[model samples]
Target: MIDVRDLTKVFATPHGDWLKAVDRVSFTVAPGEVFGLLGPNGAGKTTTLRMLLGLIRPTSGSATVAGFAAERDPAEVKRRVGLVSANTGVYPWLTARETLAYFADLYAVPPALARQRIAEFADAFGLGDFLDRRCGVLSTGQKQRLNLARALIHAPTALLLDEPTLGLDILGRRIVEEFLELVQARQLAVVLCTHHLEEAERLCHRFGLLNRGRIVRQGALEQLRAETGLHSLHAMFLDLVGARRQLPVTSLKSAAPPAPLT
Candidate 1:
C-alpha cells in the first residue's frame, strides 16, 4: 500500500524566491489498485514521486509505503516499491534472461528463487523467445517487457510508472497495456503518472487530477466525468483547470495537511 498526506515541495530560485513545485498533495493507493496522477507539464507529478522515493526532502507532509515512512526509512520504502519509467534502459550487453537475474541479485533474491521468477515472468510477459538474446538486439517491445519484468524480479509491493508508454509505437504501447493487467493481478499498488488520459481511463481504478501544483480534483473516471459533465479525462481536465480562475491559488499555511491513513 502507498499513503501520502499533505506532501509539498518548495524550491529556492536563484533570485531568492521560492517556487512551490507541489502543494499540499495527499492521496492513497491500496494494494492491487492503480491510481493515475494526471497533469500537464509542471503539475508536480514528478516532484511528488521523487518525494515518495525520498530522493528529495518535502517542504511538509509525509509519504509511506507498506508502513515505512519514506522520509524516515528511505531504504525500506525503496525495497517495497519499484519504479519503471519511459527512460528505463536495459544494459545493452546483458541478455534478456541475464537482465532479470541481475536485478534479482541486486535485491538479494535467492539464486534459486530468482531463476524461478525469471522463468515465470518470461512466460507471463512472452519473453521466452528472446530470453537468451542480448538486450541491444531486442526490439523495443521486447526490451520494455524485460524492463517491466526486471523491475518486479524482487517482488515489490508497489510500483511507480512514469510515462511507461511514451515514445512507443502502436505495438509497443499494446505490449505495455497487456503488461499493466499482469501488474494488477500481482496485487501491487501502482501509481501511474502519464499524459495519456485515454490510457489512464482504461487502466487506472482511480485518479488524482493535478494542475499548477495543486490537485484540482480527484476520483474515479466515472466520478470525474460526472463531476465535470465531461466524457473524457482530457475534457474533464481542461474543464477543471479552467475553473481555477475563480478558485484562486493560495498558500496552505493555515490548512492542515492530510492525515496518514490509520
Candidate 2:
C-alpha cells in the first residue's frame, strides 16, 4: 500500500527564486490496485515519484509505503517497492541472468531463493532464450524485459512505473501491459505515471489528473467525465489545462499553496 498526505516539494532555482515542483499532492494506492498519475511534461509527476521512493526529501507533508514512512524509514520503504523507468540502465558487461542475480544480492535475498526467483522471472518474462546474452548486445525490447525482471527479483509488494512504455513498439508495449496485469493478479499496489491516456484508461483502476503541480481532478474515468462534463480524458485534460486557449502557462508562486484534494 502507498499513502501520501499533503506531500509538497519546493526547489531553489538558479535565479534565486523558489519553484514548487510538487504542491500539496495527496493520494493513496491500495493493494491489488493501479493508480495512474496522468500529466503532461513539467507537471510534477517525476518529482512526486522521487519523493515516494525516498530519492529526495519532501519539503513538507508525509508519505508512507506499507506502513513505513518514506522519510523516516527509507530502506524499509524501498524494500517493499519496485521502480521502473524509461531510463533504467543495464550493466553492459553482465548477462541478463547476471543482472537479476546482482540486484537480488543487493536486496539481500537468500541465495537459494534468489535462484528460484531468477528462474521464475526468466520463464514469466520469456527471457529463457537470451537470458545468458550480454546486455550490451541485446535488442531494446530484450533489455526492457530484463529491466522488469530485475526489478521483481525481490518480490516487492508495490511497484512504481514511470513511462514504462515510452519508446516501445506494439509488441514491447504489450509485454509491459501483460506485466502490469501480472502485478494486479498478485495483489500488489502500483502507481503508474504516464502520458498515454488510452493506456491509463485501459489499466488504471483510478486516476489523478495533475496540472501545474496540482491535482486539478481525479477519479475513475466515468467519475471524471461526469465532474467535468467532458466525454474523453483528452478533452477533460485540455479543458483543465486551458490548452484550447493556446495552453495557458501557469506561473510558479512560493506563497501558500492550494489545499489538497480529499
Question: Top model by TM-score, which number?
Answer: 2
How does each model score on TM-score? 0.89, 0.92
Clashing pairs in 1: none
Q: Which 10-residue window in model 1 sums to the lowest lDDT?
A: 240-249
Cα distance off (Å), candidate 1, residue 223: 1.6
51-146 in candidate 1: lDDT tens per residue? 999888899999999999999999998888889888889899989998888889889999999999998988888999999999999887788788
Highest-scoring model, lDDT: 2
TM accuracy, model 1: 0.89
**Which residue runs of candidate 1 sit more than 4 Å off their true CA positions?**
240-262
Q: Write one digit per residue (lDDT tens) for candidate 2, span 129-158.
A: 999999999888888888889878899999
Q: What TM-score number comes out for model 2?
A: 0.92
